[model samples]
Target: MNPGDRASWNQTANADFVLVGLFGETKPATFLYMVTFIFFLLALAGNTLLIVLIRVQPRLRTPMDFFISQLSLMYLMYISMTVPKMLVGQVTGDRAISASCCGVQMFFSLNLNGEKCFLLAAMASNPYTAICRHLHYTLLMSQRVCECLLSGCWLLGMSDGFLLTPIIMSVPFSQSRKIPSFFCETPALLKLSCADISLYRTFMYVCCVLMLLIPIVVILSSYASILRLIHRMNSAEGQRKAFATCSFQLILGLFFFGAAVYTYMLPTSYHTAEKDIMIPAFYTIITPVLNPLIYNFRNKDFTGALRSTMQLGLSPRKAGNGRA
Candidate 1:
């Protein structure tokens, strides 16, 4: 590498970053952090419960439930990545994060966020298959097919992290090391660069568009097919059931993708410090807490499994007999 590039790398490699988190040191900020912590706990409990219920219940061993469980797992990992550090920073009054730690955080965040985009699209296929192709549903969404789709999501998502993190982190950062957002989001980190990043920004923009566009097209088309099939159904009951099956996923995809588009796809001219902080908080903090609740309350199969698990847990006699 050239001496100029080596110096820039050295500066970035040794730099320590301070995160300017979501709130200030005012009483209101303290209250907000408390609320954030509460949401984090709820997300932790809810996703964990959903995963356990899916695992232990034979009734929930279908392709739909499998996708939901994976979604829950992703939510679990996503929130765990950012919220704890934010909370810790809040409590200790230390928002300093090392450059290495920041890159690592950005890596996983990109990885999981990308994975979720495709995963949601893959999940939309379940309802489309079930509603629009009932005869071929079993064949199309078999366990093998589901596994392959999931593996593809993981691989594609990880590729984003692996390809982009190093390039972004290697660029020279401004001497001012404070990141405006609560987490090491790519956009926020880009603002810290001292170099002219116009070319890289355009490249990143194209990458983000492709990452978002492919899954979005898949999801929209899947839903459109499902809607057409539902419209043609003779029974209102069948239509309601089909809509119910898809409602949670549709809601989730909207919440997730809407925030993601705002964060990554929008022009830099539209972004302010507050919008950057608030928007990421919405998807990273708020959505994870809501996902499990939406799935659990709206999903009869999931609720039934949860109820059964609770009953089994509470019954000493049944538990003992099963163990014996």
Candidate 2:
């Protein structure tokens, strides 16, 4: 596949490749489809409610919550793009997609992935400022700053997807264009190319490392510093409070990074298409569903805010009687 000369490009027969279910058996695939569908619903509902609560309540309008609300929205968008195709593919048994369809999938997967990485980095930085530099957190993470950071994240993510577009276009898709994976991943797309894919492989490897690995490193480093700073607090009560703030992020970050690296960083030989679907479900479905509940329910302020929201809606109207 690595010969760079254009003379080597040869057309192949259009053979339909049957896409198999993810786990090892057909029975389990049906079970997993139901389970994943339920997870998709929970993830959507939880994240949507999180956004509504954030927007409807004025007291939740801090810099951190603002970014968190954006995070929830982005997660919802990301999952929505991937999960439905997966369900349809599994249920209807229509595995193959047109070249344009595959291209769209690739674009969204990369775009959402890069943006989510950038968002997590911002999320980690949010607490770092609040914990390490409380006095200057206001100056450091203002509304303007938050907007600029988020804008930069979206731009950087789009840049990564745009870079992939030209390379993906040049690849000659043989008559047999079926991708084995549930969704279109770049590597799986690369395998279908009749053209030499060495350059594309090289490009993807570099981008993945930069967009994925570097962010993971930055997040881990930021959290390490946070933990250290938290440990150094003078009072036990202050330390406990700081630990509570940092713990949710650490757990969610670990789950996101762990599943991602496991899915993408492994050798090509290890990548049977069956493995791809399961790992993505964790970050996409499980993370979003868990994020709002874990973050809000654990926090005292947000719990009180939620309680207030409930009470506000339930207050009884005054009776017409003057002195009952």
Candidate 3:
């Protein structure tokens, strides 16, 4: 082959994959991008505040709050994985992502997604122990137990990344290096492979089912038991408070797991380009923004903690001003 032809071949072999961003360069797309950027900011700030509040406030340092802080950390990491790159691509018009970098992104995204699922399931134990095993809540969910559960979730999540990333990245791509979605998601990357992936697709479907199904079972069973206990209680206010505490967790689980089931558990034949893009967007972009607001903003404890933190922050300033 000639020098130019060889160079062309090398380019084809090593070229970075280009991302088709979430929006186009039209007016509405611009508005949507702006809105998304704002959501990113809100998610970042909200999760950060929750983590800080839980750490600094003694009253908020229960098993449930410990799980909430971990969830906040997961959301913080999750949004950081995809949104910033997408926003930069929107602003700079440079959408090329190196294959190795794409693999790294996919690994972290998958790991965090798995961690959130397991963490949510683990969180269900808190409410169950709190209400049903009220006397033993502390003994059941001790600091040691909580730390072990957290460690288990992290290990399971990392195992998911380690298992899936290499398998997906091992496949050779066709000449076209464009990924249809905004990030290096599993489905989008698989669609670009030149090889037959029917077997791998089936394998992935099974993996997704096990990954999603196990936690879902745990969550449902835990909640069902809690519901039975709540129903047996005579005090109306007690029932209401118990229900309220569980509801936020149920809502968060529904949002995250429902979107995940739609994205990963369903048959690929049922997936359309538009549906694929939009559903993942709900979890990846919108859910992070909703988590902190739904989980904490409505909670009296969180708001009280926020008020106390604000007072503490302002007290020193007030004292300084009085002296001046």
Candidate 4:
């Protein structure tokens, strides 16, 4: 195809390309690909194990587990959005992603963001129930209630993904379509649009500020109060245990919030492909792996439950009572 013909074709179809630029040149393509592929595999395995553990262990059937499951599922989608494109781009240096691919990436990315917000909010509420209203915990956070909350989070996230992605992608742009990021991140996509992005930018900022900012504020405020309440406890063990609970959630929240703010708030005009990819990697990939390890595995209760479940699975003599 001649240059003019190819240009015409490019306008109609999405071009696929790799977005990671490790050095000034592309000499490290193989190394970058291998590193990314390894992380992708780790993330997939870790999140998968978390989901399976949550499902099989009846002791894990709590509100916290419900949110943890959602978070894992979102991370699975998070890795789904970026890893395949990077793999293809890495193998062949033709790292160009077409418009349709961009749309898909954008949708999943937004959905995951929304889901993260909802899950965090739900998590915050779970602690409040246990700490503030211990007597009514079971009644207030019944199975049906927890299911409704989880379903609402998913539905809200899907709605946000569908509504906002199309609005951004519909911008008329005949020139300047090189996305610097590994995937179609919101800010990067906006920067590529030919249309005036002022309003859309404002909208995204408001949505993010409301969704992210408010929840973070609420989380921090709740923890602050919880800390004071814990300090007032006369028993040394009570204080230690309460501090431990607060610390776990606080650390996880900080990681999630810090990575998110960095990714979303950076001026798209100033964003580098490397930074964009790295920030999301922290939140979506690393955080998911850490969530179960840090929160669930470290808990003595969960460990005991896991051991019991394993023992139950290994009880072969009990199985002899059943018909072959």
Q: How many residue pairs collide in each prediction?
A: 0, 0, 0, 11
Candidate 3 residue pairs that clash: none
Model 4 error, position 1 (Å):
28
* Index of the highest-lDDT prediction: 3
Worst 10 residues of 1 by lDDT: 5-14
Error of 3 at 211 (Å): 1.5
Which has the better TM-score: candidate 1, or candidate 4?
Answer: 1
What would the per-residue lDDT of candidate 4 be over residues 1-324, giving only the tens digit for each residue?
579756765575454433543222466767766777787787788678768878888778888887777778887888777777767766676667777877888888888887777778777877777876779999988989999988887887777788788887765544657666667877767666554779898888877776688778877776777777777789999888777877887787788888888777656665666776567667766676677777777887677877887788878756876745
Task: Summarize candidate 1's per-residue lDDT along 78-180 as a digit string, tens digits.
Answer: 9999989999999999999998899999999999999999999899888888878889998999999999999999999998898889988876788788998
Residue-level lDDT of model 3, residues 75-155, one tens digit each, is: 899889999999999989999999889999999988999998899999999999889899998799999999999999999
lDDT of each: 0.88, 0.75, 0.89, 0.74
Ranking by TM-score: 3, 1, 2, 4
Off by over 4 Å in 2: 1-25, 269-274, 314-324
Write the residue-wise lDDT of candidate 2 on 168-255 in tens digits.
Answer: 7567766566565566666666777765677778887778788888888888888898889877779999888788878888888888
Taking all chains together, each candidate's TM-score versus the true structure is: 0.94, 0.85, 0.94, 0.84
Candidate structures ordered by lDDT, highest first: 3, 1, 2, 4
* Regions more than 4 Å wrong, model 3: 1-13, 25-27
